[model samples]
Target chain A: MSVDLDLIHRYRRSTLTRDELVKVELELQRSPAWRSALNDTVDAHRLGATWAAVEGSLDAPTPSRLERAATRLGAPQHLTRIMGATPNLRRAWMVSAVVLLLFGLAVSNGERETATIALFLSIAPLVPVFGVGLVYGPGADPAHEMATVTPMGGLRLVVLRTLMALLTSLVVVGIAAVLVEERSILIAAWLLPAVALSAATLAVSSFVPIRNAAAGVAAGWLTLVVIWARIADDGVAAFRLPGQLVAAVALAVSVAVIAARRDAFSRAVSTT
Target chain B: MRTEADDRALLARVSRGDRAAFDELYRAHAGWLTARLERRCGDPDLVDLAVQDTFVAVWKSAKKFRSQGDVGAWLWGIAIRRLIDQMRKRRPTPVEANVLFDQVASAEDELFVGGLHGELGESLRSLDPDLARVLVATAVDGLTTREAGQLLGIPQGTVKTRLLRARREARDELARLEGDSR
Candidate 1:
């Protein structure tokens, strides 16, 4: 019935029972001063700048979400750490792995005709290039800028992801190669082309947008294979020693170009 | 108030690997979790690490989250466990007394404690640390007495008693300061 200051304080502290709270609510409605006092008490306990400080700390660098997931799924601790340390590359790795599996399934057991197998292998090496394209540059990864500024930077990140894509593609293709009738030739053809195309894609990416570079390289390779098949009367000629020599030369040149312009990948070119 | 339905929807999206939804959940809970964890440990780095670990766990185990429970409380439980884990790895150095006092004073000022010459802030700073902490947990931090007890490792009744004493002391001090200022 009366305004007890201590009772009001207890009410403000939320230490009151349900009945007591109801009583205090009624009392508070009858007294503006009591309400003001309660507000003042609450204000005095304010955690100034604490929220902003915490929010800033949250923005501090940590492992990427995929890396954390990998760790949770029982990946090797060091491998997870490496994956976590590299941001904006998980999607590329995942896409590369999936592409390899699907491509391997399509070509395994010599189920398809020889022409179909040749065409598939010819295009299969480009799968990682596409994956690499999706990893960097504008319009690809939403976190491209963040990835660019990371301690790993763009060149190392691109290389790491490309290597991952290449390795996963190799393993999948290698397993599928064992199932094919012409295992040695198919492996040789695909392996050299995969490395050459991946390196060329990376090299071109340093100078142009990754998407454009990847598209250009893919189109040129496909056209060359088509032209070679027409002129030589053998579609698999592009997979032979002469073709492998060209690929080896392409790989070397691309590697040299990539090394010379390595700094180009350090800063992202915003296409948007 | 964040509804259980909203939390459930966000968590469901997170379980499906929606990064945006996980980000939304993080923004919603990171502040309060940081505040609560900081109360237990003075080390900012440790608190930050615990917050990070808690959200990472949430992202990984979101599918395990029941749709019917309080998401904030569940997050709190996880944050507390993370704090414990960090403490086990290395004990955090206690915050210096002067630094604590300065923080309380600065926070009071920053909140613009009302009354002539900000008597409320002065009064709050005048209370015993034990009483002030109880008040902060129950009032400012909006924890129930039982929750405050769980956080402070005290009985609920003790939290209630300390909270009462804290308020009484604050009221008397505020009155005295107001009377003096006038």
Candidate 2:
């Protein structure tokens, strides 16, 4: 099909009716030769061939977070440290919690053999959580390209990270159970707070911004658990109310951020 | 033929561990890739990272090309993919940090300025988010109208309407610029 370049030029120079604009746009859209030229440009770029050695290509404006991230002395290194330390720290926390639990259990049950067996059985699920979170942090969003052009990748990344973190928390709690073998009553002690914190941490990621949220949630949860551990008889029960509230908000925020920014997420994934 | 040629020509050279070829490939494609990615990212540094990453990926995976399709498309496919990954990894920063392309002294500077430009580029810059995207997908990036619709999560007709709007804007801008020059 012949493209009337003159008509296109005319259309540009004068006010065309909406229908006329549409027709010219359609013509531009249908111009195979034009497309072939674009394709050739894409091809030439791929081939490491150019019409000439072009200097600078500006493309887009720079975003600040990236600037901050790149300029930060130890961001990637810090992220790497988190990768290395998380599992180890989690393991340490699990071991310490378990030791505490077992010591309490022994004190309460007076070295009863059956208590040891019960304690071992209770804390088994905690191991996996320790491993998963260490391996994948709460913010570990992996790369996927084609799917990034859609919203699916963002949703998938967030959901996957959430699951990993939750699993990590649960695993840590199980190990805590083992440590508190004798004080199985303490397992009865702050089990609710532990569970609540895990969910709340995941939920908080949505509202407080990306990098800071997980640490904030974890810090806040630990502080609360400690405060409750010190102050009350039924700390587990006390946690249920606040935990549920945070969890509800967290879930809402996660959903809203994902929904409101679906396009943004898609754009992110596409442009990455 | 495209794939075979690509494999024998570019991929083979890259796979042979030629950094020069990779660099050459990067230089050839970086301008256009930067331009397209800038449209989506609205950030220059991120676009630079994306461009750098596309080359890194090409260095690592060029051997995988197998030369079955257009290498430009393949490279673009890589650049576009990497840009999206960067975007997903971060929150959408409001897109205002344009490169100082207006300060550019020559076409060489324009070529390197990256991101979109010209009448289509200006029109795209002026459009609302949805309308702007449809124009980029169809006119600049060369996606089909249906494909543009799918990418933007809009209906096909909406894509058409938006494209029309973008074109009209471009026409007016082009006329205004021309009149000013005269």
**Model-by-model DockQ, in order:** 0.04, 0.03
Deviation in angstroms for A67 in model 2? 21
Interface RMSD of each: 13.6, 13.3
Top of the candidates by TM-score: 1
CA lDDT of each candidate? 0.65, 0.48
- Model 2, range B1-182, lDDT digits (tens) per residue? 12225334756787788766655555445655554454355566666677777776776677788555656667666776666567556635543322112122233322322233345645644455556556656664467787555444457898888778777877887899899999
How well is each residue in A1-272 modelled by candidate 1, as lDDT tens digits?
Answer: 34467755665443433333334433333333444344344321232243344345546567668677877898876566654554356456566656665665565545545675676567667767776666545665566676678776667777876786677567666665565555444555778888999999989887788778888998999999889988998867798889999999999999999999988887534443
Position B6, candidate 1: lDDT: 80
